[model samples]
Target: MEAGEDIRWLPRHTVPDDLVFPFGGKDWWLIDDRLLAMGHTEAGRVTGHEIIDAPKGSHEAVALRNALWPLAIPHGEYRP
Candidate 1:
């Protein structure tokens, strides 16, 4: 992207009952498939990052990332 963002995606809309942001509505990144760096947010702003070790729950995080990948729309194609 012109903004230097490698990839931008708009998540597909889904029913509220479905799992979304299962990690306490916080933003997160699965680092090298080994650690989960979850950001704690307040008013849409990140306040801190908490790292989750792989053995603790990285597997579930991986699965969630995999499941959501196909549902994400590239920034260039999203409508809303």
Candidate 2:
């Protein structure tokens, strides 16, 4: 993760109200908004990783990225 640049964590309760819990069955990494790496976890361990191409300029992707900013709490600044 890049300091103050490449990583962000949004508190659980601060997630968008319209979004559902367990966002997905796996963890995801959006790289440069062009590739998405999905990590499959089992028993608290990462079991596998798969990468998929993504369209960064798409309306949906742009919208999601925009919406996430307001909900994010800088790392080490969250209290819960």
Candidate 3:
């Protein structure tokens, strides 16, 4: 599916300069502020994916969402 159609996209500039790209470390998916699906990395490559049952409104989830919010631009407004 297309990004704007199935999922939102953010421009690279929206990301914080100090934050390492997930592709450079570990990758994760936070869904609905609840589920956390993380991707394991080995030798800079994704090795596997795991899902964690994170609850919505949890401190960790909320903190993560807040940290990411400032770095995200609306999908419709993102350039490049």
Q: Sorted on TM-score, highest at the top, how do the candidates line up?
A: 1, 2, 3
- Per-residue lDDT tens digits of candidate 3, residues 1-80? 26344344545566667865433345566666677777898887888888878464244655755777766666667667
Q: Summarize candidate 2's per-residue lDDT along 1-80 as a digit string, tens digits.
A: 35446456766566767774332635666666676676888899989998867464233444665678777776667665
Better of 2 and 3 by lDDT: 2
Winner on TM-score between 1 and 3 is 1
Write down the lDDT that model 1 would get: 0.71
TM-score of each: 0.64, 0.63, 0.54
lDDT for model 3, please.
0.62
Error of 1 at 29 (Å): 0.6
lDDT of 3 at 34: 77
Model 2: CA > 4 A from native: 1-6, 21-25, 56-61, 76-80
Worst 10 residues of 2 by lDDT: 54-63
Which segments of candidate 1 are over 4 A away from where they belong? 1-8, 12-17, 74-80
